[model samples]
Target chain A: MDFELIAESLPRLAEGIDETLLLAGSSLVIGFVLAVPIALLNLSNNGTVRTLSSGYVYIFRSTPLLVQIFLIYYGSGQFRAELQAVGLWFLFRESWFCAILALTLNTAAYTSQIIRGGLQSVPWGQIEAARSIGMPGFMAFRRLIFPIAIRQALPAYGNEIILMVKSTSLASTITILEITAIAKKIISATYQPVEVFLIAGAIYLSLNFIVTRAIMLVEFWLTPHLRVDRRIPPVVRRTPAPVPAP
Target chain B: MELSYLGWGDAGWGDEFARGALMTFAVATCAFLLSLVFGTIFAAFKLSSNLLLRAVADVYTTILRGIPELLVIYLIFFGGGQLLQTIALGLFGYDGYIDLPVFGVGTLCIGLSAGAYSTEVIRGAVLAIPRGQIEAARAIGMNQGQRFWRILVPQSARYALPGLGNVWQFALKDTSLISIVGLVEIMRTAALGSGSTKQPFTFFITAFLIFLVLAWLSQRVFLRAEAWANRGVRSA
Candidate 1:
């Protein structure tokens, strides 16, 4: 209700943008990279590989991300000596890295399904045609299959991105000073929960809106043929239609 | 070390973990049922002839579904108690701190969010009901209530089963978020046990296994329901 209070807190909340972007960006990139192999494995010709990949997706997808975050962050700390012996403790020691790892793993599970759906939707005829022309296995996939699958997956992937952005708010619980963390801090200081959260919510909405628009643009660019037909102006086309002589 | 901590006696947290699992089941079941009621009402409103009623239902579904569940829980946890106190005072002319039980709070939070998702699922199912069937019922001169019970609700339930199952699973998984409000569900119990014993791997892995079991069993039940619902429907 206090517009002035929210107006005043904008700068402090803005400071958290870098951390928020960092959290979301790292998780999205790593999650996408991790998802590709899992997705491919899920669709593998080998039954064992397919089962293993599907099992991974099932386990990760069924559990809550909050549990995963705690398990990685605090749970990994329980194995300090062992991890230190392997020189991997440093990775888990930092809250940010742990947050990223958890989010990446979680999103990878979901994204693998999305990607697998996309990959599955590619018709067999296209692959057959490519093979008929003697397109190599890798070449055909790279040229024909991957592009089509990515286009199919883009919209779902965009939803995953927004989900991840929202998921990053969990990092605030682990002391990662993202926008939500900053909002919490501001609220504790100002004792104005509504204003702080309102401003923070606006930030999230704007960020999500921008990301959604960008993904849509990418989708548009990727499928130039799918765009609205601009071949002829309406006025020119509407002028007494020239009927073909029967 | 892990075994002792989770041992089935006073020396460990076996009882607490078991109780937490029970509480999770209790809360989820209550929330699921509540959401079903809430969903049916909202869905009926959505399908109602009144434009204003439809708009109200639409707005409820949109805001609840669009926002993250965590924010919803936070708002409820912080504001719910005060709201209850205000209501209590208005109704009974009594003013005291109204303590909402963790079960009540967690179930209500989960129910509110689940109801939003369920409203859409139920609405879609109702809309999918063939117009001819309703017309036939009308021609048969059945009362409004009878037509709804005998013809519409049953058919809609069959159609809505799969989507409602999805919403149920979503609700189950989301119950873990209620740990923040101190519901002491499986996730919270595991977190607490892991923190106390410093055996994170064991407790978390155990929690994960429990969830997998619940999810797998629920999916099987839903699949059974789906099969039963679709019985006698021929596919070419």
Candidate 2:
């Protein structure tokens, strides 16, 4: 109900959206890059590769991201001396780097699973057809398998993206001044936790809404053939133009 | 740095960590139960004939699902107390502090979020139940309550067990967030221990192991439950 306070806080909270987006966007990009190979490894016939990637996914998925963030951010402090010796302390020392690193790893685990499901769902008959046409292995995978798998995975990956966006708020606990952090700051300043949180929640909800709509657009684009209009025939009128001509 | 720091009794945080684990279990259980109740109600709303009820359920799930759990927790913890105090002042002319317990707020927040997810799962499970069975029950002159208890509940529960297992895992992990509100859960215990001992890696790694064990054990339990639930049923 404190209109003036909420009005003053809106602009400051808006600034944090950039930080939130950057954290989520970069981590998602990196996580996807990491997920592809892991998903492939998960589908591999080689037992060792499959086990290793499965283990990676299990460890990351089973643990909470908060502990991972703390472990990376604070745990690294315990290794500062050795990291500095290796010239890697610079990366470990920044909360942003640690936050993104944790987020990337956690997301990669989930994404790999999504990608694996997609890959598995790619019909073996399609791959066989590509092989029968003399398409090379890598080319067949890239052109035939990968495209189908990605389209199949897009919806689940969209959910993952929303999750990662919401998760960026946890970085606030690590001293990252994202929206939640900014909201907390405002709450302390004005003693209006309810108003501040309402604004912050609305911002997050809108961001997620946009993300969901964007993903749905991509889903629609990816599967145009699945659209009902695409399948239905257009209606035509015969002999109606003769009267106009007369 | 000494191993004794993790030992039980006067020298270590072993007792506190154990107690914290118990608290985590307690919180997760309460929240999970609350989530199931909320989820069932909302799922019914979603499946109801009324447009208004369905829309209300949709909005509830969407908004809760969209926001971060941490912010929700903070909102309830801080804002809930403020609202209660204001209401007390207005209605009873009382000018006293109203403190909502952190455990209640934490459970409510986690329950609300988890309920959104559980709504989807339960709805899916309900939809998975074949209509023919319900029809058969009615043809046999079974009452609504008997049909519900005998056919609908068991079948939907079988279908929902796996999803509910995932929700339980989520709830367990989410209990960690409660530490931010000063609850003496495992995460908070680890934080306290690490802060006092200046051994962040040690305590956190301990916490990680504890969570991993819980996740592993829960997975086993769910697997067993799934097997039990599917007893005598043919697998596709």
Candidate 3:
């Protein structure tokens, strides 16, 4: 490894970091919003909706993300005239939108499954209690059901986030000047793949470390009862000597 | 005015596509087997009493799981070449031109990622074995080798079937990424056909269907194995 070359390339690689973060962060946020409803549809009793949702998930999840990106970027361009006529070509003109669209759809398929599993694990008693309290179905689901499911789903979702962050490397294939793209350029120019990739790996490790810690904090905050109450272990609700019939 | 590029005749890509599918299967099988070996070693390390060995296993799994498959492949393909060349110079005392073949590099990358996931599955299965079973073997005067082969290995293999099946599917799909390193797998072949024929939709759809078939077939095989393994047990 050439220390001088690595030192020289640090700033340029750092510039790539911003684009990398933008690609991953934007796709993750958008993917999460889209996945929730898809998850619900997937779990619905309606056969048609369930089949359609599951098929969407299957197709997206089964194929590699690279192919999906290529299809969107190049395959869809085959219809540029038709898309342009409908005023959608403006969005499709840039590689950024294509990368985001592909990543969003792919991540959504995965996150929806994670979320569906979470919703399925919600205890039936909680929903029954909500109904007994005269709470409306939508109100009960929003307040009681969604909260518990989110907590259970947070760990898997955190894994998904890390996967997405690493996946942003694919954006480089679309000519996006993300970290990997920049690293590739640096290597071609200088013939130093090992050093550049090591730096890139370090960058990813640090970013994922921060993201994992943030999610852990969120999980802790959401389930305060699960945390050990420093004051006592289990605090066991003492009967206080039967209280003399008080 | 023509859709003959996808036809099966001399001018069509029918031949190329078929060859690509064959390559995908070969690479996937090789990589899967390599992963099983790597995974078994790492799983054993994770279960070992030495803290340093356990830590090495942990770090290996973390880096493999934490990074993208694409990045890992790139690292293996490009960095692998450089590392090999360096070692060749140092150890062999001679080096003219050193480079890892595309297939070698690709298999290494895929196997590396697959092994990380398999380590978890194998470790889980090993843990799932009832502690008493091992104790019983020991009490019966079975040696370590006998106990491992007769009891631990068979039992863990049965329990690990489902998770290993999923990993196989993952390995199958991830083979597509190796196309970047010029392996001519389904994905790369589709890409080449699309670019040359300018019919991206036709080839991409073909690639997707091939993977779907592989996934379905692998799932069936694993399910059959699971049933066979559970033969003596009472079903609930």
Q: Pick the candidate with the highest lDDT.
A: 2
Model 2 over residues A2-101: C-alpha lDDT tens digits? 9998899999999999999999999999999999999999989999999999999999988889999999999888888999999999999999999999
Name the top TM-score candidate: 2
User: lDDT per residue, candidate 3, A65-108, as tens digits?
Assistant: 88788878877777788889999998887999999999999999
The per-residue C-alpha lDDT of model 1 at residue A235 equals: 57
Q: Give the distance in Å from residue B123's predicted Cα in candidate 2 to where it truly belongs.
A: 0.3
Tens digits of lDDT, candidate 3, B18-43: 88888988888888899999889999
lDDT of each: 0.85, 0.93, 0.88
Query: DockQ-based ranking, best first?
Result: 2, 3, 1
Clashing residue pairs, candidate 3? none
**Candidate 1 clashes between residue pairs 3 or more apart in a chain or in different chains:** none
Clashes of each: 0, 0, 0
Best by DockQ: 2
lDDT of 2 at A231: 60
lDDT assessment of candidate 1: 0.85
Instruction: Give model 1's TM-score versus the native structure.
Output: 0.88
Chain B of candidate 2 versus the native chain B: what TM-score? 0.96
Q: After superposition, which runs of candidate 2 have C-alpha atoms over 4 Å from their true positions? A: A230-246, B91-96
Candidates in descending TM-score order: 2, 3, 1
Winner on TM-score (2 vs 3): 2
